[model samples]
Target chain A: MANRVAVIGIGQTHHRSKREDVSIAGLVREAAQRALDDAGCTWADIDAVVVGKAPDMFEGIMMPEHYLAAALGAVGKPMFRVHTAGSVGGSTALVAAHLVAAGLHQRVLTVAFEKQSDSDAMWALSVPQPFSAPLLAGAGGYFAPIIRAYMRRSGAPNDVGMRVAVKDRLQALKNPYAHLHLPDISMKMVEESVLLWDPLHYLESCPSSDGAAAMVLGSEQAATVAESATGRRPAWVHGMAMRSEPTMFAGRDQVNPQAGRDCAKDVYAQAGITNPRAELDCAEVYVPFSWYEPMWLENLGFAAQGEGWKLTESGATALDGGDIPWNCSGGVLSSNPIGASGMLRFLEAALQVRGMAGEHQVEGARKALGHAYGGGAQFFAMWIVGSERPN
Target chain B: MSKIPATRQGHRPVAIVGFSQNHSVRSDSTSNEVEMLLPVIHDVFDRAGLTKDEIGFICSGSTDYLIGGPFSFVTALDAIGVWPPKSESHVEMDGAWALYEAFVRLQEGDLDTALVYGFGKSSLGDLDEIFNLQLDPYTMAPLHPDLVSLAALQARAVIDQGLGTEEDFARIAARSRRDAMNNPFAQIKRDDDVATLMSEPYLVSPLRRHCLPPISDGASAIILAAGEKAFDYAEHPAWITGIDHRIETHAFGARNLAVSTSTAKAGAIAGVGEGHVDVAELLTPFAHQELIVKAALGLADSVSINPSGGPLSANPLMSGGLNRLGEAAQAILDGRATRTVAHATGGPLLQQNLVCVLEGA
Candidate 1:
C-alpha cells in the first residue's frame, strides 16, 4: 500500500497585474518562504523541490527551474519541473505528493507561478504554425464558442454568467490576496462591461496577474512532527487523480468533458464519496470564464447534466449562506496567474479543511474538493482533502 | 540528510518491458512530432503484445520552444488516440524523468502498466540561440552565450586538470562513430581513426567537430510494467533496481564543471556501485562528457560503454536521455548483459543528472 500524505502548509502571493517590485525569482521565493515558515521548517527539512509554470515563452526563459534552483534551496537535491498547460499547478503538486506517498522522501516543497507581465501570454499561445489554419485567436476566442454551445444546450439565462461574475468579485473582497477586489460589484456592473469575446465580458474573464502558489506536502511521519511544532492540523489528502484526452477529436464533448468526469469519479472512489454535493463542504474550481463555473459543476458531478446553472441561479454556491460554498477565496475568476491559478484553488481547498482560511473559511468544513482543467479542456486534475485521515 | 536506499521499503518493482525508436536524422521535414511518434508508439505496443487500452497511464517529456508554440504536447497526444480519456501527465524534462514519474505512480499499486515517450526536433530552430534561454535570464542569458562555448569551458577544465587530453576526446568520438555503423537507427556512422579525427580543425578551443553530437530529430517510447505484468510483456524484463536524479546550482561559477557532482550523488543513491555492471549507456552529447559521467558512475573498465554509439552519433535534445535508458535496457533484454547502468544529463555543463541501475530477472 502507498504511504499516506498530507498538506502541512500553504502559501500564495498577493496577486497583481504587475509585480515590478520583484523579479521572477523573487515572486516564487515569496510564496516558497512563507510555506516553509508556515510548516515550521527550514530549507534543510525539504528533501526535494518541484517547480511548475506555463510555457517557457511566457517569461522568455527556457526551463527556469534550472535557474531558480538556488533561490528555492534545491542545491544538492532532486529538482523536478512539470508543465501540463494550465493544470500544471495541480499536477506539479500531485507529483510532489507522490514523491512522499511512494516512500521516497519525507518532505517535499512544490511551487507554481506565471509572471505574465514579463511577456505576452496571448502572443505566446497564439503563435501560428505551418499547415494549420489561422482560425485561432486568444484563449478567450477559442473558448467562447464552447461557452455558447453550453448555453444553447442548457438553455440557461444570459444573466446567469453575469451573476457569477458579480458573485466571485464580491467574494474577492474577502480575500486580501485576490487581484481584483471589486467592492461595488453587481449585476449592473457586469452587464455594462465591454464584451471581449462573444458572450464573455471583460469582467467575466480572469485577470492576467503575476503571482505564485506553494505547498509543503509531507508523509505521515513528517505531518505528525509539523502538527506538534505548529499546533495546526494538516489537510490529509483523501484522494487525487488526473486524466487527459486528445485536444481535438471528432464527437468530443467540450462543454462537459469526459476527462473531467472520469477524473472526478476516480478521486471520489478513492475518497469513498458517494454524494459529492452532500459530502463536500466546499470547492475551489478553475473558472477563468464565468460560464465555466456551471459547466464544471456538472462535469465534476456536483450537479446533474443540464441543471448546473440552476444551482447558480438558486444561490446554492454562494459563500454567505449557500448550502455548498464554492470559490470561497475568490478563485481563478478573480486572480489568474495562468500557471498558479490552479494551485490557488487547491491551496484554498486545503485552507478550508484546515480551518485556516481567516476571513473566507467555510464554517465547519470537514471535506473539500479542488479542481483544475487545461489544454482545450482536455486535461483534468482534481483532489479531495479532509480534516480527518482516511481509514 | 539520511542516505536514501536504492529501493525503499514497500516500493514496487517496475521493469522495462518494451522499447522502440525512430531512425535518427538531421531533420524530419515530412512529419511533425505526432506523426513521428505514431509509429514508435505502435511499435512499442506491438513488441510488448499489448494494446493501447492496456496502458494504465501515459506521460511524455518535451519542450515547446522547438515547435515555437505553446501546448505542443497537447496536440501530440493524438499519437496515443486517447479517445476514452486516460490517466496521464507531462514533464518539461527528458523522457527519463517521465519514466521516473511512471515508476513512482506504479508504487501506488493502482497502476500496472504505463507508456513513456519523448521527442524533439532540434533542426526546427536555431539550437545555439534557443539553448541560451536556459541560462540565468537576469545574468548569463543576457550575454547570449551559446551551448558550445559552455561545453568548451568544461572540456578545458578536463584537459587542464590532466583528466584527459585532446587525443582522448578524438578516440572517444572515433569509437562512437565506428560503433554506430552496426546500428540502423544511428544518424552518423563512420570508420575514422583517432589520428584522422585529431587532424580536423577545432570548432571551439580544445573541441573538434567530431566531438559534437549530431543535430538529429528523433522520438522514442518505452513500456513499463509492475509485478507479474512485467513477465508477461517480456521474456527477460530489465527490472529497474534503482533510480535517482539530482540537480546542482545553476550558477556556472559556483560549480566545478570538470566533475559532475550531481551525477555522483544520484549514482550513489541509485546504488550504481552495489554490484557489477556489464554494460552502460551514457548520454554524453559532447564527447568529453562521457569521461566525466563514467567516472562519476565509477563503472569498471571491463564494462562496455555506448555499444549503440550513444548520443555522440545521434543526439535529439529531449529524447537523448530516454534513448540512453532504452539502450541500456535493451542490453539486458537481449541477454548481452545481466546488469547495466544508464545516465542522462541536462542543463549547460551538466547542471542536472539522472542515474538508473537495471538488472535482468
Candidate 2:
C-alpha cells in the first residue's frame, strides 16, 4: 500500500500580464518562500524539489529549472523537472506527492510557472514544423473548431459561453491573487468583445499572464508535526491520477476526451466517491476558455452527456448559490500562466478543503476535485482532496 | 539540519526487463522522433515478450529546443497509439529521470509495468548556441558561452588540481574507441594508440577533439516490471536496488569544478559502495568527467567502466543518460556481470547527476 500524503502548504504569486518586478528565478522563489512560510518550515526541511513548465520557448530558455535550482533552494538536493504541456502543473505536483507516498521523502516542494511576457506564446506555440501541415494558427484556432463541434452536438444556447466568461470574472474580484479583477463584468461586455476565433469571443479566452504556483506536500508524519505546530489542518490527498492519449487520431473525440473521463473515474474511485456531484463540494477545473467549464462538467461526470450546459444554466456551478461550486478562484479564464494554470486549479481545491480560501472559500467544503488538461485535450491530470484522511 | 534519507525502506522491487536502442548516427534526417522511436519501442516489447496492451503506464523524456517546436513529446506519442489512454507523465530532463519516475510509480503497487523512452537529434540545430540557453538567463546566458568552452573550463580545473593529466584523458579516449569496435551501435569507433590520440588538435585548451563526445541522433527505450512480473519478462532480471539524483548550484563560481558533489551525494544515497560492482557505465560526455564521477562513485579499480564505449563513442543529448543505465543493465542481463552502477549527468558542467545501482537476483 502507498504511504499517506497531504498538502500542508500552498502559495501563489499575484498573476498579471507581466511581472517585470522580478526575474524568472525571483518570480519562482517568491511563491516557494511563501509556501515554506505557510508550512512553518525552512529551506532545510524540504527533501526534494520538482519544477514544471509548459514549454521552454515561453521563456526562451531550455530547461529553465536547472538555472533556478539555486534560487529555489535545490542545491545539494534532488531536483526534478516535468513538462507535460498545460497539464504539467498538476503532473508536477503528482510527482512530488508520489515521493512522499512512496516513502522516499518526508517533504517535497513542487512548483510550476510560466513567464509568457518574456515572449509571444501564441507565436511560439504556432511555430511550423517539418513535414507537418500548418492547418492551425494557434491554440485558439485549434480549439475553436472543437467548441463548434460541441455546440452542434449538444445544441447549447449561444449565450452559455458569455455567461461563463462573466461569472468567472466576477469571481476573480474575490481572489486577491487573481490576475484579472473585472468588477463590472457582465454578459453584455462579453458579447461585445472581439471574436478572436469564430464561436469564441476574446473575453471568453484565457489571458496570457506571468505567474507561478507552489505547494509543499508532506508525508503523514510531517503533516502531523506541521499541524501540531501551526494549528492548521492539512488537506489530505485522497487520490490522484494522470492519463494521456495520442494528440490526433481518426476517431478521437476532441469535444469529450476519453482521457479526461478515465482520469476522473480513476481518481474518484480511489477517493471512494460514487457520485462526484454529491461527494465533491466544489471543483477547481482548468477552464482555459469559457466553454471548457461546461465541456469539462460532462467530461468529469458531474453531469450527464449533453446536459452539462443545463447544469451551468441552472446556476449549479456558481460560487454564490451553487451546490457544487467550480472555479471559485476565477480559474484559467481569469488568469492563465499556461504551465502554472493546472497547478492553480489543484492548489485552489486544496485551499477549499483546508478552509484556507478566505474570500473565495466554498462554505463547509470538505472535499473537492482538481482537474487539468493539455495538448489538444489528450493529456489529463486530476486529484481528489478532502478535509479528512482516507481510510 | 535534517540529513537526507539513506535508503527507502520496504519499497517494491523493480527491474529493467527489456531494453533497445537505435544506432547512433551524426544525423537521422529522414526520420522524425516518432518514426525513429517506433522500431525501438517494438524491439523492446519483443525483447520482453510482451505487447503494448500489457503496459500499465508510459513515460517519455525529450526537449522541444532540439526540434525547435513546442510539444515535441506530444507528437511522439503517435508511435504507441494509445487508443484507450494510459497512465502516463513526462519529464523535461534526460530519460534516466523518466525511468526514476517510473520506478517511483511502481512503488504505488497499482502498476505492474511501465515503458520509458528518450530521444534527441542534436544535429537538428546548433547545439553550441542552443545549450547556452541552459545557463542563467540574467547573467551567464548573456555571455553566450558555448557548452564546449564551459566543459573545457572543468577540464582545466581537473588538470590544475593535479587530479589527472592530458595523457590520462588520451588513454581513456583511446580505450573507449577500442571498446566501441565491439559495439555495432557505437557512432565513433577507432583503434587508435594513446600517443596518436594525444597528437590530435585541441577542440579547446586542455581538451582535445577526442576528449569530447560525438554529437549523435539516437533513441532508447526500456521496459520496467515490478516484483514477480520482472521474472516473467526477463530470465535474468537486472533488479534496481537503489536510485537517486541530486543537483548542485548552477553558478560555476560557487562550485568546485574539479569535483562533483552532486554525483557523490547521489552515489552515496543510492548505496553505490554497498557491494562489489562488476561493471559500471558512466555518462561522461567529456573524457575528464569520467575521472570525477568514478571517484565520486568510489568504484574499485577492478570495476570495468563503460564496456560499451560510453558517451565518448556516442552522445545523444537527452537519450545519452538513459543509454548508460540501459548499458549497465544489459551487462547484468547478459550474464557478463552480477552487479553494476550507472551514472547520468545533466545541466552545465555536471550541475545535476543521477546514480542507479542494479544487481542480478
TM-score for each of the candidates: 0.98, 0.98
lDDT of each residue in A81-110, candidate 1, tens digit only? 999999988898888988988888999999
Give the best candidate by DockQ: 2
Inter-residue clash pairs, candidate 2: none
TM-score of chain B, candidates 1 onward in order: 0.97, 0.97
Write down the DockQ of candidate 1. 0.82
RMSD vs true structure, all candidates = 2.4, 2.8
lDDT by residue (B25-142, candidate 1, tens digit) is: 9999999899999999999999899999999999999988887788778988999999799999999988889999999899888789999999998889999888899999999998
Ten-residue region with minimum lDDT total, candidate 1 chain B: B1-10
Against the true structure, candidate 2 reaches a TM-score of 0.98
Off by over 4 Å in 2: B1-9
State the DockQ of every prediction: 0.82, 0.83
Number of the top-ranking candidate, with lDDT as the measure? 2
How much of the true A–B contact set does each candidate keep?
0.84, 0.88
